[model samples]
Target: MAGDKELAGFILFLSQFPFLQAAKILTISFIGGSHYLLMDEISRILHDNGHQVRMFRQFGDGMLPGRQAQQSPYPVSTYSLGEKYLAEYKALFTEAQKDNLMGRDSLQNFLIFLNELSHQCNVTLHQSDILNFLKEEKYDLAVIDGFNPCCFLAAEKLGVPYIAMFPGTFMNAAKVGVTGPLSYVPIFQSLLTDRMDFLGRLKNTFMYLGSHIVDKKMDALFQKVIDEHFPLGSRPSIADLHLRAELWIYNIDFSIEFPRPLLPNIQCIGALLAKPAKPVTQELEDFIAESGDSGFIVVTLGSMISSLPLVEFLKEMIDGFAKIPQKVIWRYKRSEWPQGVNVAHNVRLMDWVPQNDLLGHPKARLLVTHGGLNSLMEAVYHGVPVVGIPLFGDQYENMVRVKAKNMGTFIPPDEMKAEKFASTIREVVENGCYKTSAMKQSVILRSRPFPPDQQLLGWVEHIIQSGGGGHLRPYSYQQPWYQQFLLDVILFLSACVAAIIYLILRVIRALIYFISNRKQKQN
Candidate 1:
């Protein structure tokens, strides 16, 4: 009787807290750089939450700098193609860079990159061993890299419901039934903000339509892989498969992104990597401390491109840094520095810097970046102003947000001069309004009802416990294109109006004829 009472007391104590059930989750990633980091962070979050998590990473070339030697805490299954594919992958970036330098259209190179991804997908699917292993695991859920369509195909093959974690803005939000009114909501890559002039809206309209065309071309590339791998009758269109995802988690925050409508199944968990700053190394701390009231600046062009391609551009940047009073810590390869160029007295170049740590430091004043989303979010997280030097891709678009928010400004690469670059940097740093805006954004982000981690964890668990996100999904995805956009209804209304107008005209004509005939007969 005493033992039973003790057990009942213990159970009662446990009932005070919410109970959580552990889940088995598999994270699929085939690309590297920021994409890898995002997926890796997701897996870590799940694992830390007492879930059974495993990572399946397929090796691609161009791993993020400083992450090459880092190891994961959870179990990881890694696969790699031969050196030939690696060499080819590296060469593609070089060719694309050259195209950009020569002012040639680089869209062709981007398409080639998509084709390469498709090829990699095709090769990976044929690996019987990997397939068997994944099947044997029998994961309860899959978290996929949304940027890579191959990850979606892999999840489909495994017959598991998956969540897509997109590392960029939801440019394809329409695919999942989110409304993006072109009149206000700027199309991705268009670089326009929520507020636009007439001309801006007109340009946005064209880009909005062009986006769909580009998506179709991209889908066609991936469709080839599906055709060869899946049975003919069972093949699903890439768009359909995307629509079927349990949820779409975008790496964006309203603090940095323009205000836009979102559906229940889509969530924004931007800056997943942002956290409390850890203390920097003793050597770095000493350097930052020496900056005194001026405060040090963090400079990095993201992980992909460490060095400028043109010597003149490099010299301009160096000369610009020379003019600044505040010390600069730039992430540039020492070997890539021109032999004759003099190093700035206030600048320090290192192969890598603990970016988040430096940004979070009390003495940190500014960030000089390439306008990558990850870097932008980190800057927002730490309340640091920016001077963006956009290289390519969505970098330009990302900078637009920076300028719109009044947190910083950007310099076009082609138009960059030492005086212009230095003046822009100084203006942002010396101006109190820029820093105030950045800090305000940081406060808004941090003061949200649910922090990013909690949001991710709670929603993921909700989906798992609820079996799927079908309850949250809207029926819009199932509607035909015309019906979804109300085009059919619009056409029907137009036809009805036309019929009514025609009938009114005919009645008027008859009335006039009858009056004229009556008058003639009376005469």
Candidate 2:
């Protein structure tokens, strides 16, 4: 309580700047339930601060994560990517569950989805309704999804300075711009730690470089869209537009991530966007209360991948849960649920459950998750141990940190057996180390000097007040890529060494000719 009060006082002190005034803000988020949730939170904060806030996102029947689209507070404009790509989206995750996410087949499926998403975004940005509204409204600032290059292009067209918001610790082609030192920083899905021996560092470097190569197709697709729209003037490439954002707010913080240097423009607001767990219903409360001394466990794969029906995996989970005395709640789509797996009396299945709230419940013993950043953050905030079954994109890497910190353990879905999966759950539940480490880490997470909301509003206003990040923007951004990488310095050094070598060769040839003439005269 004292720390929170002190932090509030500090924020009040910083709020005295003259430039702090209300402005019109435009926010955009396309696809993904978690993505929209982060954007919704930022929009709400800005709106509460006396700013005119409007949001743009995709909406279909039953799309938004926890609520209907009508319930949103902001003035929202929803677009549809149409049903054509919907099947493709489902198929992408289908292939992901069948093959390892790191495999060639799965990557190709993901790339196809990226291309489809890019094309859809291009249509949305150019549509008569969305573009005309954006042009006329002339928002003071645009808060855009960092993954969507089209949003950056839209904000640029409207002549609005914008900030980038990421749902997780940065991934995708945009990472190419902000990649830190390769010696220590691990790429998403690499599963490498910051601490590395020579062999590990070598592997890390390859994975980092290889990720860029694989993402070039997606980058090219985005570039094609950007070029068509912004071709009239001095056009910056898509990479340049990413670095030009006034600020970047990431959904990850230092406690869970490996140590790495970051630019001044980047901020870690982590769980600040996460809403406190709402109260569970009395019926659900009764169910949990009935579990007695042994608490229940919660299972969710997050909003995106939760619907996948992995036949054997589901059976293994069901069989494993049957052996445990603790009650279990599994959030899964009933339409997709396999008939083969027999649900035990101790287990209940719901199409949607309040995951964050359930994790916060005192009777909640553990979390079985896909390791999405949002799920992980909730678990950490509530101090619940995890059993990770990572599916795709950063899940593996996220779980690696979970294992390293002793907060949880993970089983790759392919290697998962009924007995092994059950035992892993039992281990996390019975072992005191997992719970103890989780509580200690929770202290570190909650102990940051500034309250997350204050930190968020402070930096957001700072960027706007200073006229777009001011000196916070790195000088390296202004330099050409060659200069940034020190290639120019290397070229100069190479030329100097070559000139010295040439001179030395000439001197040796001249001496040899002189010696031969002397020998001829002596003869």
Candidate 3:
């Protein structure tokens, strides 16, 4: 009798708080590095909020062993790509780094990377065992990594509603019926800001048109995967799958990104990783205490590039650090250090540093980074100025925003002389305005109505409680391309005006002829 009463009470309590109902969530993480980190963080948030979350990780050949081996609180299942494919994926990054080091264009590398992703997608779908396991789980929702189209395919196969977590700004917003004006809004990699001159707008327009060509190419690459796995007649295009996402959680904020139109289902939670600083270790604290009035600078070139043996670049950077009075804490692998280069007296090189903690410290004067969005957002959160050395991909574009915001400036590899690099660092550190601007951005980011984690949790629960994002989805997604752009309406209006002008001309000609005939008859 007591047990029956307890059960009845539990049921009554659940009825009062619908959100307390736990959801079974499946997250797909195909990429490693910071991409994997973001997915892991999301999983942690959901798991802590009474949701049963599972991570399905896909490992490639060159992924760090540490990353693959790291344990998660929730259940995790992993799939490894074929040795040959992963090897190629790893080699591509190395080659791209070489090109960037030499100041050459690495556009070809991106194309190759996309091709590898398609092949990996093919390999993943062939795993019937994995697919069956996922299907058996019967998850209520899927959180997919937007970078990989294959994740979307997995979700579609399971027939579960999904949300895409884009790790950067939504460059492919148009794929989901959200459009940005080419005039003011810069395209993904154009490296142009929101404010542009006439020439800049012209360049942005061309890039905007060119992006479609790239999108079509990407679609074609993945179409083969879709055709083989999905039924021939019912196979949905990649764009169609993207449009079906219930929500898009972009790792971007207007505090860093320029103001642009957003859909109701799209949310920005860029500072997901930002939080209060924890105390540093005894050794690190001792180093900071030694610096005294001259605070230290935190330097990291991201995970991938930090392992490369760029002797020339490292030499220049070492010399630059020697010139600055501030102590330097750089994230570089000691094993990969060039043999002849002498280490700077005040510089400390470690395989890894507590980047966020260091940046949040009171003595942190500046951040020297590769301009990754993760690092930039951390810098913004901590109100630390930056001196960026953009290596590849979106790093260049990210740095453009940093400079535009007046938080800091960047030095290209071609211009990376030791003197120039040192001067750039000093400029940012000495200029109070840069620090002021960074603090202002930090305030703006922190002053949002809801913290990033809260926003993420609340919105995710809302979608689950409401049974998908149908109510939030806009009608523009279902419209034809011409209709979405109003080109058909414009064509119709143009035809009507043309017909009216033609009819008026005919009437005028008739009147002229009648008047001429009357005058002739009178004569």
**lDDT-based ranking, best first?**
3, 1, 2
Error of 1 at 502 (Å): 2.7
Q: Candidate 3 on 137-190: residue-level lDDT in tens?
A: 899999999878889998898888899999877677767667788888898889
The CA root-mean-square deviation of candidate 1, after full C-alpha superposition on the true structure, stands at 3.7
TM-scores of all models?
0.93, 0.89, 0.94
Q: What is the lDDT of residue 330 in candidate 2?
A: 85
lDDT of 3 at 449: 94
Clashes of each: 0, 0, 0
- lDDT, candidate 2, 249-358, per-residue tens: 88887778777777788888888644567789898898898899899999987776555555666677788888888999888776766665667789877777888889
lDDT of 1 by residue, 431-491 (tens): 9999999998899788889889889998889889888999988888888889977999999
True-structure Cα RMSD, model 3 = 4.2
